[model samples]
Target: MEKRMIHLDETDLAILELLQEDARITNVALANQLKMAPSAMLERVRKLEEKGVVKGYSAAIDPLAVNRELLVFIFIKTKDSFANDKSARALAAIPQVMEVHHIAGDDCYLVKARLSGPMELMEMKRSKFSKIPNIISMRTTIVLETVKESSHISIEK
Candidate 1:
């Protein structure tokens, strides 16, 4: 399906930037920041959601605090170019798999996973990954240090 392009005004863009920074910001507070009435601000926000500009809100959790310190990027090679997507969907069902992308180049998929430590990684490979069909091979790259990570997108009018 093709996506319908939605136009956003300056106010809508402002709301998006502010909301991205702090999703918990109250509507009255948001209105004060943009110097608009609360009702007007709320209506604009509602429209933004209806138009699909504002997808949804979520909290950012600290991976370390949750004991998910080990970060690894797994480059997966699959057979048949994943025409059926059975293997792709099965890989996604695992709890540790954070992000999966159908990538170009030598590999078919690039998967981001979080684990407690090396032991869990080994267990995932043996028990979880070994069950998925059509997975030809996987090359794991452990992250030594993360300079920066963010989910915020620059909203433009």
Candidate 2:
């Protein structure tokens, strides 16, 4: 099926801005803040969802608060043959993995992981990562500090 792109007006943009600030805001409260009727506000929200503007809501959790120690970015170079089901299965079994992106350019994939310390990272590399078939190489970088982290989409409309 052909995909259709939805254009957002100023009102839609405003609604998105408010929602990004607080996803849990009730429709009534949101309507009051936006100076629109609750029903109208609800309709706009439903339209946004239908158009895929508002993908989904999620609770932002503090990694440090939960004893998540190390944040590592791993650049992976996989053999061409590994792109099939085996590579995906190998990646899925790793519990420390937070996110994986299929990247362009030299690196085949970029993997984000949270672990306890260097020891855990090393163990993961030695055991699970090494065992993955047709992995050419893996480069890892530790994040000392995060300057900024945000999920808010900057709407240019």
Candidate 3:
């Protein structure tokens, strides 16, 4: 199948900005804000999804409220030969992992993980992660505080 690029106009961009702020906003409310009919607004949103502009929606959970005790950024350098789908899949299966980014330069992958405490993080390193074959090295940095985190994407239209 061939993929087509759909260009978004200013109105579409505005709609996206509003939705990013609150994904659960009702279609009628969004239409009122954008000054368009609800049916038209819904069609635009459906088109955005079809074109893969709006991938999906998710709730932003407060980590503190859920007793999340730690946030760690792990840099992993794997053996060049071992960097493949097998290794990536192995890392993804670990429950503590929140995000995995394939990086350039010295490190092969960077992983963001949330855990209960230092002890749990250490146990994960020794038991689950270390068992993965051909892992060259793993470096971890615990987050002291989050300065800024925004899901909003800047759109120029």
The TM-scores, one per candidate, come to 0.92, 0.84, 0.90
| lDDT for each residue of candidate 2 in 1-157, tens digit (9 for 90 to 100) | 3788788888899899999999999999989998999999999999999888899999998887876779999998888553454665577679999877767888777888998889999999998898888678888999999999788888766
The local lDDT score (0 to 100) that residue 17 gets in candidate 2 is 94
Candidate 1 lDDT, 1-157, residue by residue in tens: 3888777778888999999999999999999999999999999999999888888999999999999999999999988554567777888999999988888899989999999999999999999999987899999999999999898996666
Q: Please report, in order, the local distance difference test score of every candidate based on alpha carbons.
A: 0.91, 0.86, 0.87
Ranked candidates, highest TM-score first: 1, 3, 2
Please give, for residues 6-37, the per-residue lDDT of candidate 3 as tens digits: 78899989989988989999999999998999
lDDT of 1: 0.91
Candidate 1 stretches with Cα past 4 Å from truth are none
Query: What is the lDDT for 139 in model 3?
Result: 89
- The residue pairs that clash in candidate 3, if any, are none
Which portions of model 2 show Cα errors greater than 4 Å?
A: 1-4, 81-93
Clashing pairs in 2: none
Candidates 1 and 2, the one with greater lDDT: 1
Whole-model lDDT, model 3: 0.87
